[model samples]
Target chain A: MSLLVELSNVGRDFDGGRIVAVDGVSLAIEDDETVAIVGRSGSGKSTILNLVCGLDRPTRGEVRFEGRAVNGRAAWAALRASRIGIVFQNFFLLQSLSARENIEVALLGNLGGARQRRVRALELLAHFGLAERATLRPAELSGGERQRLAIARALANRPKLLVADEPTGSLDVQTSQSVMSIIGNAHREFGTAVIVVTHDEDVAALCGRRVEISDGRIRSDNRMTAMPTPAPTLRIR
Target chain B: MTELTLPLRGLISRPLRTLLTVLGIALAVAGFVALTGLTAGVQHSFASGINENGADLVVSQRSAFNLVSSAVPKSLSSGLSAVPNVEAVSGILLNITTADDAANIVMAGWPSDSFLWKDMHLLAGRIPAPGDQWSVILGESIARALDKRVGDTVELQFQPYRIVGIASFSSVLNQNSAIVPLEGLQQLLSREDVFTLYEVRLKRPLDKNDIAVARTRLIAAAQGFEVGDTEQFSSSIRIFDLLRAIAQTISLVVMAMASVAVANTLLMAVNERTFEIGVLAALGWSPRRILRLILIEGVIMSAAGGVIGIILGVLTMEMAAKTNFAAGLIVPYLSGWSIAQALIFVFIAGPLGALYPAWRATRLLPADALRRI
Candidate 1:
């Protein structure tokens, strides 16, 4: 498959070079690839993800999306809106909106009208098996439910790439398993290239390949022996 | 969905804050309407008085800035009448006094047979007779204020006069006034040969050219007199102009304060929803879209406030028109133009208030914002 994201000699420094967040890191993510970036805290896994998502410019070297260099804030913003989707560790669902409305917000900047937006939101919620809780707000939903809703919102625009920054960090073991399976299923069904950053071995084991980061550099890059297939359904009932 | 429901949901989530912000804008807009209305009413009264009376010219003492202070010799009336094209000329004496309170009550003295007196429709009782020295005609407004009826004795400046009639004048100046015989009031004020002003009427359906020629002739014939048509008469009043300026200044200050209140509310919303804004960015909303969202919030709040304020302001003006203080002298007028002006001000102010907040929101990067708790 064609390379979807490519980073060449990318380096990001903070505090006037006093701190090296990500130094001389080069990586390539191909279309429909499910890759996990595993690292301990302060190992720059999140920083690398930011570079790949075009949210941050490398101080030196280049970040390319679809073979074009992510040059400026405008370029990065365009890519994020049309081609890339991100899920946060905290879920980051708008607290004021219901589960359905949160997903609708993603579709708002698109060309469709209100009715089309509503249809898409409902469809996404149904896919996540959270249709019954569509009217409930983020605070009203359980942690696992919130994560699933966040994922649904991220996929609202049918993005080609899905970036999850510790997607299951806030969930319990059983809830984490459910959330990871949902992400895997989305990657499989939508043919979206998935890049998940996590320190947990269980979360890393679910991906087809794993890249380990340590001390602002890639420590190891290896393929998994067996890819863990996502469960068919995660029905809360 | 985002244009209508999403911003509304954001505002509804914080109901109390939205309410307080809307209320602040409402009060400011109401204050703006009421203050301007009072001045507009006063100006309207003067113009309506001269226009409705069908008088072509008002000949007051030269350099006199107000009606109460003007003094023209009664002899000027004869000269004014003799002017070519002059159909009739009438003399009037006016003064301002406090009845029982500080509010000024205009007292006008008109010739018993003059057209000025004829113009006032007597609501009850008869006007003073030609030789009646001790009779007074009360305008409807003054009658209500003094609580006097027909045949009741009203003591004016310690002189008791029998109330012969109660009248209603559409012109605000005459509405809050008490009228008496020209000779009687002249004797009372010890200015028998002098009058406050002269009302000159031209031949019926006179063209503008005819009125202008007559106006010039009257001015040339009467020395130390200012002969002007209704338009000049209304514009020459210094007090009306001053009141309008004061009203404008007050309205501006109130509008500025309301804008500040709106800005404060918008800024708070941005601060509280930083993470949500970040998520929106991550989901594909551009900085411009985020800016529009915040600005729309401000616009919605201001527009809602402006509508409520307009209703309240109209009601307040109506109440003022009925009050003793505004009776005769002023009827608070809220014109369509003024209402439109208030709305336009709010619409502009609302967007201006949102500018800084929207810019601040746009500056929030998704990467940095998501990092914050």
Candidate 2:
């Protein structure tokens, strides 16, 4: 497998002098791999996802995406728009536009004609069983519906790498299952490199590998030998 | 040239705020444009009123606002006529009188064939014949008000006069004035110098010394004599200038207030849509593009407001044109130039007001914007 992302000795400091967000953490995710960062709040799990997605520049070391350093604004912008997809905790869908427009808007940042983008947005929504609800605003959507829309918007650019920060942190357990299932289907559909920063053990269990962070440093980096089967049983019943 | 569709969506997302801010901007620009329009009209009318003379000097009673009681003896006209530098002098009496219906009208008595009548545009009918004492010339306002036509007879205070000719007005809403023969007004006004003052038409413009030389002779011939050039006549031009300054100052203040309203509304919008702006930035939109997008939002608001205001002003002006309108709603102005200037003012103001707010929106870091989300 090819290396999709490599975070080399990344460290981040905040609070002007006192607090450190990430402490010299180094990690790599291979293409087609599903990785989860599990930790408590502010344990630098979100920070690691942010750095990998090029949302924030590291204070030390380097982040390579597809084998190139992205430290400047322009470089990060290109890396994120064409190569990466980020899903946020709060389902950051623009409230004014419809769900389809939310997904269609992402096409403006990518390479395609208007008609093609529209067709693709519809296709993605239909695959998620949300074709009927594509015209609805974010305000009209449920929490699970919002997370699904966020996932749809993230994949609009056809990114090779997908990074999510607490994507299901605010949802109930049932809705969280629905969100994870939807995300799993999307990851398989696009052959994307998936990385999720979450606290839920079930969410972490769905990923092929889990990396734990403690006080800004990685404490565990291990692969799950056997994936969970609770989701399949719930779907059948 | 930024991707403004997203920013525009942000603007409409909060419709009430957008509407209020846009209205505030429009009102300001309207106030500014309308006032300046009036100023331009007033000044133009005054200048046109005096300059309409092809005359070098206006020989009237000094400082008299009206010519009704300021008549110079008719013999002064003959004396001015004989001066060496003066080519011709026409004595005219302009009286503001009421008809039996109590509507105000201007009645002027001058020699029908004199050059002064030539200065007045003839909309209809022929000039009054000599000894044609009972004939009248109605200005546009009086003609419309009384519903009189050429060959129609109107009852004056003393006698019935035929509406022989109609005189053109500088403005549609200008007061109505009539023209009759000088002999006719002497009888009605009951005075010998029924002619208010003589207008001296000079053969050529005067140099400084010639002006001084002409000044002495004009005063000796006609008492209360004053002379003014085409550009320096304050009596006809200054009132409009003062009015114009007042209008200009008003528009400036309104523009400032409008700018604040626009900026305030945009500032709120920027803060509220921070995440959206960040999203666009994350999507590869440059900060400059984001700035332009916000500025476009401001300009669109300003433009919408200006269009509403101009429509209102023009409608008000048209309505005033249709009625007697005792107070002038349509001031004397250069309409085309004034409206053009007003539009330019709005365009510049819209962009200027949006500058700081757009910059603030652009300054928002993408991560910071998505922080809460």
Instruction: Report the number of the highest-lDDT candidate.
Output: 1
TM-score of each: 0.91, 0.73
Clashing pairs in 1: B176-B328
Predicted structure with the largest DockQ when compared to the true one: 1
Q: B1-373 in candidate 2: lDDT tens per residue? A: 1256666777677789888887887676666555666555444433454455556676765544433555466667777877778877777776656643546555667776678777777889988887788888777767877788999988775678898888776743233666677777778778755466566687676677876677678778766655555334334433445667777777778777888888888888777777888887665566666788888888888888888777666655445434443322235333676667667867887788788888887666677677845
What TM-score number comes out for model 1?
0.91
Off by over 4 Å in 1: A14-19, A56-61, A225-227, A232-237, B50-56, B60-64, B70-75, B131-134, B157-159, B171-173, B184-194, B205-232
Cα RMSD for predicted model 2: 7.4
Residues B60-154 of candidate 1 have per-residue lDDT tens digits of 77656665667788777777888988888888887766555634676677887788766679999997888998798887877887888998987
**Model 2's DockQ score:** 0.24
Give DockQ: model 1.
0.63
Q: Pairing residues by index, what is the TM-score of model 2?
A: 0.73
